[model samples]
Target chain A: QTAATPAPAETWLPTLQVDTPQQGFDLAIVMARRAVKTTQPDVAVLKAQRPHYAGDAARLIDVSGVAAAWFATIAAANGYWRD
Target chain B: QTAATPAPAETWLPTLQVDTPQQGFDLAIVMARRAVKTTQPDVAVLKAQRPHYAGDAARLIDVSGVAAAWFATIAAANGYWRD
Candidate 1:
């Protein structure tokens, strides 16, 4: 019973000229993925790419919120978690 | 019997001075996560970041190779996937 969070696109969207909410979300996700691939070509995560960009977000992922979800598993598996 | 793959640490490790394979792996993963976070702060993946850089790679992920894994899911969800 809550509202969906407004992404950065909502506030400055008119300036950037993004059309819809789904468009903004899509744009953000692609940018994130590209960031990882272009920056680190040797990481294990890259080793598992499915080519079509339809991968899952991991059922076991979620470290309080989305901000930490991306790094939680790797840090714990690497034994770098401190709490 | 099977042999584990040799990470970058094993090759030409004398000059760059990466201590061990584990260290190399850790270094690579960290670099990947940092690249994504720093480059795409507004992205949802960043929102899901756990600060420790240990997030799961996603179960339903795998695009034949690592290159495509990074952008696979969002592309499909965004209706950008073709094959």
Candidate 2:
């Protein structure tokens, strides 16, 4: 019987450095959930197009823009911007 | 003095129905943050491309895939999947 060789670790396309792996994974789940819901593309289409969309999205995250967006979102959630 | 007319409200494209706006916003912040880091594109280029990235990412959220990703993340966190 041939033993299966383990595959090399995947370098997640998004180059995030979260406090922990769990934190990053959690964020991915939340983001993925929202993304799927937002687009609501056909299941078959989504399966076919996931790589392209994920790749494009990863390439879009600007440091300043993401910082601004995240800050705005968090601030808004905390009612910092509204008052 | 001329008064400025308020613009129409934006209908968030992703069509998510979160329990609270904060939940959605928080998720958005997490996703955007991770995405921004993952790609690590030039700051100037990122600014020019934010809309496209966010839009494309939203479109990529697959129901089964996202659910699986999220579930796996949660399960891993709870040590359910590992021996």
DockQ for the candidates, in order:
0.03, 0.05
Candidate 1 Cα misplacement greater than 4 A, ranges: A1-16, A42-83, B1-83
Best by lDDT: 2
Off by over 4 Å in 2: A1-21, A53-83, B1-83
Candidate 1 at residue A83, lDDT? 30
- The ten-residue window of minimal lDDT in model 2 chain B covers B74-83
Give lDDT: candidate 1, residue A74.
27
Per-residue lDDT for A3 in model 2? Answer: 59
Look at candidate 2 and give me any clashing residue pairs: A14-B38, A15-B38, A36-B61, A38-B14, A61-B36
lDDT of each: 0.35, 0.41
Best by TM-score: 2
lDDT of 2 by residue, A1-83 (tens): 23587775333323222344445445544544444544443566546555664466452342223333333322322334233
Give me the displacement of residue A32 in model 1, in angstroms: 1.7
